[model samples]
Target chain A: MKKLISTPYLLWMAVFIIVPLIMVAYFAVTTADGAFTFDNLAAVSQYANIFVRSIYLAAIATVICLVIAYPLVMILARIDVSFQSTVLMIVMLPMWMNFLLRTYAWMTLLGNNGLINMLFGLFGLGPFRMLNTQGAVVLGMVYNYLPFMILPLYNVIVKIDKSVIDAAHDLGCNNAGTFVKVILPLSVPGVMSGITMVFVPAISTFIISRMLGGGSNLLIGDLIEMQFLGNSYNPNLGAAISLVLMVIILLIMTLLNQFDDDEDRVLM
Target chain B: MKKCLSKLYLALVMLFLYAPIFVLIVFSFNTTKSRSVMSGFTFDWYVKLFHNELILSSLWNTIIVAVIASLGATILGAAAAVGISGMKRLPKTIVMQGTNIPIMNPEIVTGVSLMLLFVFFMARMNLEMGFVTLIIAHITFDVPYVILNVIPRFRQMDPNLYEAAQDLGCNGVSAFFKVVLPEIMPGIISGFLMSFTFSLDDFVVSYFTSGTTQTLPITIYSMTRRKVSPEINALSTIIFLVVVAVLVINNVIERRNLRKRGVVR
Candidate 1:
């Protein structure tokens, strides 16, 4: 009876989730006439630079998130226990609003005649060209995904026993030493999860790049999006690109999951 | 001094996080469409937002999809979770891992993959990709979340509760409805809300599947793409307010429930 109840869901998953993915794989290797070919896969190599740029920009953003989030999470962990939830709520409140609007807010702030330049004009500085740059794209990623990094790190670090820190100190380790050896190693799971969370979204984001990067700085996402939705209109190429992206992400996640094995073992 | 510095750091991080939102909210009331320069304040944009047919229609679509998709996912996921809890090792692992695919996969991949499926099938069926496809895609991504949320509740539930109800003269269906349902009610509610929020905020998957139909995010995307407008700012302000209201109400209800359960003083 219990197994019977799950049949509908299993059927739904097969139809929607598994089958669709299979179709992506199927379409990727096929031409417009449905003839099997590797040309679609070969076509993806032309966008090699965009692939590199996506990974590069995503890495930078992930690093930036880690750098920014770690100290903030440490501070968050140290605060009064009673106040933590409220502060955490405040941290996540922006996510409740539309992310597109949040990214649009950056567009206004970074535009040549936008708020930042307006503020610069007050100091008699010439308007700097900040918008439509790779910097702006990375900024958007870091701005949007910082919370993803913070949440996981906070969850892991907060659960760490207070006496653990005392033990490091008693063992004659200084503050920096304690952080490097004790806190850092202990926070590995959080760090790994945080990196995965931020990196995946940052890499996959098309909206942030399109809104902020203008015409010049296309990422892998933009390339894939163009093949289908944009003026380019090539589903075969799009499916090939999507398949490669899935494999890349899968590879990265497999690596991350390997790192998370210790945590999984503990849970089990 | 150290404590003070930590607090200052916290404040600055908070500032970085909120500055964009603050700017958005403030500019919503600006009289002009100019994104950079702020003129005198007016409620004109807010008023105009009501008259905008495209935005209004998209908002309606978003709400409808979220409601229906979440409802479907919750029911499907809760039932699957119950079933999975009774399964043996190999099948359980296979099903659970399958459940994680949507959750773990990038939204773009999920969106395009489903688009391929729908387009292929719809072409054969001679159906257009629009509302029905959008709902299916939403539910597809949403079910994993519901399953994840609900499965934990099943683990926490006493296994004998159904038997106890049956011993009290209830049949299998009645026992489940009376006892097991209440035990997992909180999980089901949370799963529903999570699915709803995900569906509401979703843009990427909806973009691929919706065809000509527009959800709020897709509408916002196109609006932003075409040009900057104060009306978008107005919409953002409204959305922000609505989100705040819902979250606050949810929090209050959660606290009240905890109090009733004597989990909190």
Candidate 2:
């Protein structure tokens, strides 16, 4: 009976997730010339610039998300429970809408003649070239991924004991001291999760870079996308790039996990 | 003093977070070719949007995909959740972690990998990519989310109830139906809704798998790439409103349930 109930899920997983991932691993090894060579792995060095740019941009976006999310999460944590739920709902509501629509909306706001530039013009600041820049790419990424950062932070922050803060105060720690030494140290888990969540997606995101950054700022995701759609028709190269990107992501996550472990040990 | 400053900062952060959505909603009702400002209020864009055959057809396609995929995912996820709950500790942990891998992986990776699989399959079987492929891809991603949502509820459920039912001479199937199903219904409903929303909103996976028949997001993507249209804004605004309404309704139902159980004031 249990097996009967579990069969469908097991079948779906085997056919879809496991099989597709195995295919990715297979394709990553094969060359465009139909030869099974490690040449695809060598192609990684040629696209070094794109990999660096993706990491740099993702790092910037992750930092911005951390900064923005920290205060918002702190506020949400300190608020009444009902208000916290409402704020959480509001934060998550954007996720429910179409991601493409959200990205397009960013375009409408940041384009040359878009609303933000128009507003600047009205304020006598004149139009600034906000679109098709690394700044714009980061802005779009931070906007899209802010909630991912906030939710985890909020989850961790809300669980933090208020008595801990009070105890810090009792120990002659100033507000800043308490925040830095106590609250921040305790919130490392949230910070790590938020960073992982933001950095991973931001690094791999193609649409935001394409739409908002135009043809100027190229990320690894854009390069992979170009291989498939733009000019290069090499599925092997695309697979290779994806595999490299996957490794970089895995490395970052492992580093973050190590950091988290060290922090946990210190706290303990 | 610090608290006051933090509160002010929080308000500004909220403004930043909501500003783009607010702009989108405002522009949806604007009566102009440009999306810059509100010239005048009009329903023209909404009317025009409703008239677009491609948009309407894509919307219909999206609805069908989301419904079917959500239903499929919910069934699979619920069964998995139930099965996992009945498992011993080590196997349960293994299954739980295995299911979570898809969720943790990037959407692009999932999208491209699935596209490659479909391409490989098509080459082998000569089958075309369309509804069937899209449904398969959607189910792939959607089931994990449902499993994540359902597993906790299953864990939290009292096990003695099942034993009690069994001791009363009911067989395992009858015991589960009478005992376990009722208790896990809320989790199942929430999982279904989560899966439905996810399938409805997904673009990347659908974009890869959806051959010629575009989903609503793909349709909007093509339209926006061509030209900026207030009709897109109108559609987005309507979709946003629907999500908000659903969320509020869900909250209300949850609150009512809490009140019924005397868990809240």
Candidate 3:
């Protein structure tokens, strides 16, 4: 009786989720005529710089987000309890807004003749090349994904037992020592989750790089997108690239999970 | 002094977050087409937004897809949760892991994989990609969220409630309606709303699968590639307002519920 209702969805997953992944793997290993080949996988190595750049930028963004969000979230956790929800709502409001629009907002702010440049010009500074650079792409990622990092960190930190911190203090630890020992260790799960959430989307984003990084900073996502929808038109190559991306993500998630004792919380 | 410094830091961060949104909202009222230069105040773009057929149609498409896909996911997810609740450890773990795939995988990968699936099958099946394919893609991504939401409610539910209802002379189905349904309604509602929001905001999967069917995000994507226009600013302002309204109302309702429960904090 319990099995009856779930059967439809289980079948749905088999067709949609499981089979489609198998299809990606299948296409990754085969050529256009359905003949088996390892060439597609080998072809992906040509874009080694792109993969590295994507990882580098994404890692930088994730680290920046962690740095910015950690202090802010800790402060937020210490705020007056009655006002916390309203403050959290404000923090999350941008996240609720359209992703494209948020990124587009930055485009306007960072353009050659943008608001920031206008402000700088008033102070006798020449316009800096802010947009269409790797820095802009990282900034976009940090801006868009900061809330993701904050929310998870806030969840874990705010829930940390107050007595733990107090006990550390009572046992001759200074404020900094207590934070480094008790608070930081307890927030590892949050940090792990926060890193994963920000890093995954940041690494895979094509739009941020396109809109902000312009033509120069092509990431792995752009490469895959080009093969499928853009001018490149090579589905097999796209599949191979995607397969590699999945493996990279799986590997990172595995590495992160090593720090997190709670297996269920690990996205993998 | 330290408290003052922390508050100042928080204020600066909040400013960074809100400054762009403020710029967009302010620019939406500008008479000129420029994103940066606000020449004069006007309602021209907001007026133009209403008359833009493409934008309106895409908005309509977004709504239709969000509503249908969310509803489908809610039903499918709720039922699956109920079913999975009674499963053995192995199958339950397998199903749960399968459900996590869409949530864990990058949107690009999910979009590519699904596009491949549809493209491969559609060639032989002779089915064109459009609204149906778009909804299927949305539902596929949305169901896992619903299951994640509903399963917790199932775990929280007292197992004896159904038996109690049956003992009081209700049939199994009727007992579910009377007892179990109300218990899990909050989870289902949250799941549906979450799915709806995700579908409404989704661009990547829809981009790959929609073919000719343009949703609002897809439309926004194309628009962003063009020169700056106040119409987009106007549209974003409206979207921002709608988000604010929804969140505020949800907050109020939650507060009211807490009050009713005599747990006012």
Q: Using DockQ, give the best candidate's number.
A: 3
Q: Candidate 3 on B1-265: residue-level lDDT in tens?
A: 9899999999999999999989989999988877668899999998889999999999999999999999999999999999998899998999999999998899999999999999999989988789999999999999999999888898999999999999999998999899998999999999999999999999999998998999999999999999888788889899999999999999999888978889644
- Compute the interface RMSD for candidate 1: 0.9
Off by over 4 Å in 3: A264-268, B263-265
Pairs clashing within candidate 1:
none
Give the poorly placed runs of model 2, Cα more than 4 Å off.
Answer: A262-268, B263-265
lDDT of 1 by residue, B39-137 (tens): 888999989999999999999999999999999999999999889989999999999989989877888889999988988888998999999999999
Which digits, one per residue and each the tens of the lDDT, describe model 3 over residues A1-268? 7679998899889998999899999999999999999999999999999999999999999999999999999999999988898899999999999899999999999998888998899999969999999999999999999998999899988989999899999999999999999999888888998998999999999999999999999999999999999998999999999999999999988988887786435221
Best by lDDT: 3
Task: List, residue by residue over A1-268, the lDDT tens digit for candidate 2.
Answer: 7756777787778788888888777888987556788887797799798788889999999999998888888877877887778777877778777877888888888876889889888888858888789998999899898888987788777888999999999999999999999999888988888888889889999888988898878888888777665687777778888878888888888877976764431110
The TM-score obtained by chain A of candidate 1 when compared with the true chain A: 0.95
For the second chain of model 3, what is the TM-score against the true structure's chain B? 0.97
User: Candidate 3: which docking quality band?
Assistant: high
From the highest TM-score down, the ranking of the candidates is: 3, 1, 2
The runs of at least 3 residues in candidate 1 whose Cα sits more than 4 Å from the true structure, single-residue gaps closed, are A263-268, B259-265
